[model samples]
Target: MKPLLLEIGTEELPVGALPGLAQALFDGVVDGLVKRGVAIERDDAKPLYSPRRLAVLLPGVAAEQPEQRSEVLGPYVNIALDAEGQPTRALQGFAAKAGVDWTRLERTTDNKGERFVHRAVTPGAATAALLPEVLAEAIAGMPIPKPMRWGTRDSGFARPVHWLVLLHGEDVVEAALFGVRSDRMSRGHRFMHEGPVWIAAPGDYVDALRAAHVLVDPDERRERIVREVREAARAVGGVARVDDGNLEQVNCLVEWPDAVTCSFDEEFLAVPAEALVATMETNQKFFPVLDEGGRLTPHFIGVANIESKDPAEIRKGYERVIRPRFADARFFFEEDLKQGLASMNEGLRTVTYQAKLGSVADKVARVAALAESIAPKVGVEPALARRAAELSKADLQSRLVNEFPELQGIAGRHYAAAAGEPAEIAAAIDEAWMPRFAADAIAPSPLGRTLTIAERLDTLAGGFRAGLKPTGNKDPFALRRNALALARTLVEAGIDLDLDAALEAAGADVAEVREFILDRLRHYYAEQGVPPQQFEAVAATHPQSPADFDRRLKAIAEFALLPEAEALAAANKRIRNILRKAEGAIPQRVDAALFAEDAERELAEAVDAAIADTDTALAQRDYVAVLGRLARLRPQVDAFFDQVMVNADDPAIRGNRLALLQRLADRLGSVAAIEHLSS
Candidate 1:
């Protein structure tokens, strides 16, 4: 057995390319080694890479592949025999091609009856001899997301291949790939170090590269980036609030990292802090600055490839980058405010919500009408709700939104105040899009909450009417997110809203959205370990309202608690079984005059009372109370089944019993289609 190492060195590759290429190289090598009959022990393997090199380290790979014996089917017995009962020319020819003598052939049965088969044993080849070919194919087969072709060869990669290293336990192994020859060399940090260093074996892969100024482990590189960046920011008495996503992108962009702090003009701070940070982190991948009071400062941090020979020169270069970005942001903010809330409202006329449904102006009108209609139901003044809805989407057309795009409603709030709008109106303008994600807080002001619901309802209804319902995991329109936000808003506001009524007022456009939300409830119930059928049953009856369906589902689940709930479920199953057997068979009458047993009369009376009580409770919306009362009839019903002959010779008696069973099923179904429950 011997340890092995293979490194593919190239010029600076994209930071994004390293992760996937490293994984592909590892998979390709392991698959190749296994195919060559090399046993790879767990303790003998490692795969790591930086931007400049991809390498695999394996210990104790077997010296040769295991030998195998296989049976090779040949000509049938009929074809192999001659007229004299001796082997024919065809049989001799088959044996010759198989490299076996006729006497060594074994007779066996084939699909057409008897046939001749030959046995051959293949001995494994030397591991060293197989390595070069396997390594060549695997490297050539590496799945680059997109590849290129360079030099005279047809092969293309993330970057042009410069060198290859293949080692077998400190001994050089000859392997060529994509027109490049194997060697023991690897390069280090693109700027700080250049040329190559010899790798002794798989064991020296990481430390050897480190000594040559490369940080090969991605995690170690990430930690170093974070630590040095924060330390550099702190030295300037400012905190570096680096967004997690930006930090990751920055980490991959460097090999040997240097954290650098820089400043910009303080006057640029007049632009909203959000736009400033977005420009820095998004466009430049720089960390933002925060003061002791938690306000954003006019400073930022960036990770540089090499520490500057002159610190002032680097700072000036960074300043040059942020100044233009800030200038554009400031211009957009001031221009958006000058348009005023009234002018922004006019721009909404040209914005289309959906192709088939009409423009955003049409949607705003529908939402405004719906909001006024729903406001009184939720205890908000109708005038206030209408006013809020009118202003909600006006900010969407603002110049600030035109520039940042992400700051739609946010910029609206600032502009509204600058234009001398009322405090409540300005707050509503901002709050309209209060929740943009799962963890975001819902809007709380009275008008703001009203406007939020109105907008979501309008979007949902319009999409539903347009036939773009969510399917499977494909919610391209984010309909589920809107539904979740609506549910959370209702619960948090402690507002008792009739979801069906609110949707109806939102307009006929979103009926499909309502159905989509109902479909989503099955997932919510399933995650709680409650059967989806239980939720479906409730939903089938109250599909328009999530709160109502949830209420009914909870009641049915609680009713399933009584000792006889399972028994009733079982009894209902039996009744269904009987009904299925008696398909198309009807009992025409249940003659009370033909009643012959006390159990029969008792069961009929119990069912009648349970039905009456269930009806009363249901009329009052007391679902749990109805379920509690229905459980009392289960025992009596079970007793009747035990004592009475349901298919009695007396026709009148049989009909009455059939009718009673139907009554029991009806009451149980009112709560839930109990027959649908799985045991």
Candidate 2:
């Protein structure tokens, strides 16, 4: 047994696909080896990658596959035998194939009586002899988005393979791909190290590359980049803003990294910090430096692949290249400020939001109306919410937004504030797009929450009406995300709303939209660790409000932990099934005078007393207390079921019994359908 190392060198891989390409190669090779009975030494092994290579190093792998064994079946008894019960030509042929005499051949019983069989065992092949095929199979399974064919080779990959390294311990495992044969040599940093570095063994690969100025381990290189950027930012008296996404992209763009702090013209600082930060982070892959207040400063840090002797020149190059974009952003900001949001609103009339949903202007009008209608429910003024919604999409027409599509709401917020709009109004314009992605915070302000809900309401209504509902993985309208955001804002932000009423006011099909929105809670509650049956119990009651659903679900979860919960849940299930199978109409009220069993009379008396207590809790929406009170009746319920025959032969008595169960079912289900909690 020996450690194994494999590296595929290529031209720079695409930033988006580099990690995935490495992962796929690692999974394919490891799975291929394991499935063939090759024992890997470690279970926590992982793949390593950089801009120009994908590599995997296993601590140890088996020397060879397990012994190979097989069985082959031949003609059945009738076919292998003749009427004389002697060895026939077919039996001789089968024995000849097995290289044995007909009398020495083995027989096995099958569905068709007896059959001739051949069993064989062969020695396993050496791991070295199997490496080529395993490597080839792994290469074939790469998830390359756009494969390229180079030179005269008909085969294609993400890039032309420059070298292939396959080393088992100190020996070079024989392998070849894309016309390149495997060897112990690996190329180092394209600039810092001019020649190939010899890899003596799998254990020495990473250290050897590091000595040649190439950090082969991506995590090590990423942490180094972060440290260098932070140190550079400190020298400039600011802190670097290194978000995960930009950090990852920059990591993919370098083999060796050095952070250089650069500065732009002070005049450009007049533009919104978001616009400038977007220019630096999104476009240039530079980390913007921020002050203590979390506002962008004039300095930004750019990570370069080469640690140049003349880093000042690199800094100048970074600064000079960033000026034109900053100037363009400043020009757009000043121009949009002059036009103001009201005039920007006019251009929205000419732009279409969706093909089926008419123009952006139409969407704004619908949203504005929705915002106004929902404003009162959230304790916000209708006029203020209307004003905020009216201009929420105006920034979509701005040159700043056109240049940075991600700055849609952000630019509007800045524009509205500059226009001397109220503070709440300005924040609302931006807040409407809150939680721009999954795992983001919801709208912070009441007016913002109102606007967000209203906006999403109209989009969902318009989207479902236009037949834009998502099927499979196709959600071009992002309706699923919007629905989740809407439900999350209501439940998380404590915004109480009548979802059906909101859907109706938005001109939506109430039943359809409500179900679609509520379904998102399945995932929402699942993430919160609520059991599926508990969520179902609350959902069964068809709560009208998201906050109410959350409330009831919480109560159900808490109620489930009680000692009597199981028995009560089982009783509810039994009652529900009985009521479902009843033959005729059940009485609305239980007639105590018709009760034949003492247990039934006792349960009816308990229900009349508990009814008033549950009513008070139900009115107060204290679902936990209500379920607790219902749980106390578990003993009487068990006794009644155990001692009484609900399906009595007497007609009046049967009617009374069904009515009695129905009454219990209604009260028990007032908060949630506890019957679903039954196993």
Candidate 3:
């Protein structure tokens, strides 16, 4: 095995594009080597990057491709020879194409009968010999959204390539990549190092760059930035609010990181902290400082690319660049306050939510009505939920949200509180958009949860009505995400409202929207390790409420583990098939007197007793207990199928037997259609 390294040094890449570019290059190189019949050790390939370069290191790469064998099939043995069994032109022609003599070929038999075949073994090429094409292909396959050319060359890349380092152990791979010749030398930090750093081997790459003030490993740079920024915030008696996204972007923006403590005017702290933090983190890559109480402070930390000789001058530059952004945020906040949240919401009348779906004001009205109807079901005050729904979209008209769109819900919460609305109502304004993405938490307050459900229902109904349903990654209306969020909120939040009722309140087709929500539930449960058939078993019943659906699924999952579950499910499936084939509609009530066999008599008693025992459990929504009670009848169910035949000569007996089987199937399916669980 030999150690391998490939580096593409270029002009500074976009901070947002660096991570993706590095990952693409690494995957492409490993895939290239594997496709070429090269062996690589598990976990041996890894991506490394700084602002100016993307590199991949393979610690255990094979020195050459594995030797491969080729087989060429010729005409059948009978057709390849004359009646005397001598070589013919057909065999000769095959041998000539295979570069072998006719006598040297072997005869093999397969489904097609006997045939003459030629096999050849070729020596593998050295890894060095294949590096050129492999490197070129990997580079060409990079996901550069906007590639550009340099000088007079038509070739383009994410950025202009200045250096290429391709090393195999201690030797150069001898290749050209991105218009640069492969070599052992790599560029270092732009300001800290004056010349190229020589890599003696693939293993020496990281250490060589580190010594020249370039931390090529992105993880190392991120850790250093986080540590330095925290320490800098500590010096000013505050803690650094190091968001993961801001940290990642800052890590990609610098090769050598130096954290500098800076301060803005204390008056700027009067503005909403979100607006200030947004300006600092989004416009300028700076970590905001918060006091021990978790409130934004005047102090912030900025990571510089170079370790300046005079730290104060660098701090002044950081402070100077952020002042205007903060000032604008303060102005926007003060101006928005003058208009008040209520007056600003009136502007939604003119703003279009969707052309066919009417304006944002129309959506707000629909959501308010739905929230009002849903509040009583969820045990929240109807007036509070409706009020929250009304003001939810007011933030979209705020100047602060206009400048920073991420602050839409957050800004509304602030404005509502300032306008003297109830605190819960204020919180609901923001929490209405809770679970903005997957993996986020749902609304914690009952009022918030109600408003959230109402808002999503209206959007889903409007979108589906407008014919904007999702198809193949093109969910212009985000219906799939909306459905999941709606389902999750309903089930996980312990909200007991019927989903169909809520959909009807929003003017949506109850049956159509129910299936849409359940489809999303299928995907949602799949991630939780529930098999598709398990989901289908519960979904087959078509529960009208997500909470009801969730209960049935949980009960079915537990019941599936019981030893008797399989027999019961299979019996239920057989019962359903038998009923489908009956000549007429099966009677709801079975006549016990018409039973002609002892097995039929026993099954009727068992079904009656099971229903009597589980009636209370089913009514109480204790599906687990209900399914368990029904599972106890599995022995009787299996016996009935074994000893009794439903089609009797007497019509009265046949109809009674069919009614008995119908009862059994209904009792078993009350919780879920167990037949779908049968293998």
Predicted model with the maximum lDDT: 2
Window of ten residues with lowest summed lDDT in model 1: 582-591
**After aligning candidate 3 to the native by TM-score, how far in Å is the CA of 449 from where it should be?**
1.6
Candidate 1 local lDDT, 1-679, one digit each (tens): 7878888887766766677778777778889988766787647354677767787777667777888678888888888988777889989999999987898899888568998999878898777788888776676777677776787887678788889988888877877777888878877777777778778786787788878778777777788988988898788888889777788778767777788889888898888888898888888989987988878987888888776677778778888988888999999888877777888898878887788888888888988988887787567789878877788788788766777887877787787778777778778878878687756898978788788878778778777777776777887667888777776676467555777677777665445556666655566567779877577657656533455566678887887777877877778878867655653445554456767898888887887788776787887667899878887887787788899877788656666677767767767767666655547
Clashing residue pairs found in predicted model 3 = none
Q: Which of candidates 2 and 3 reaches a greater lDDT?
A: 2
In angstroms, the error of model 1 at 100 is: 4.3
List, residue by residue over 451-566, the lDDT tens digit for candidate 3. 88999999999988898988897998889889999999999976777777778878888788888998898999999999887899988887868888999999999999999999
What's the TM-score of each model vs. the native?
0.77, 0.95, 0.95
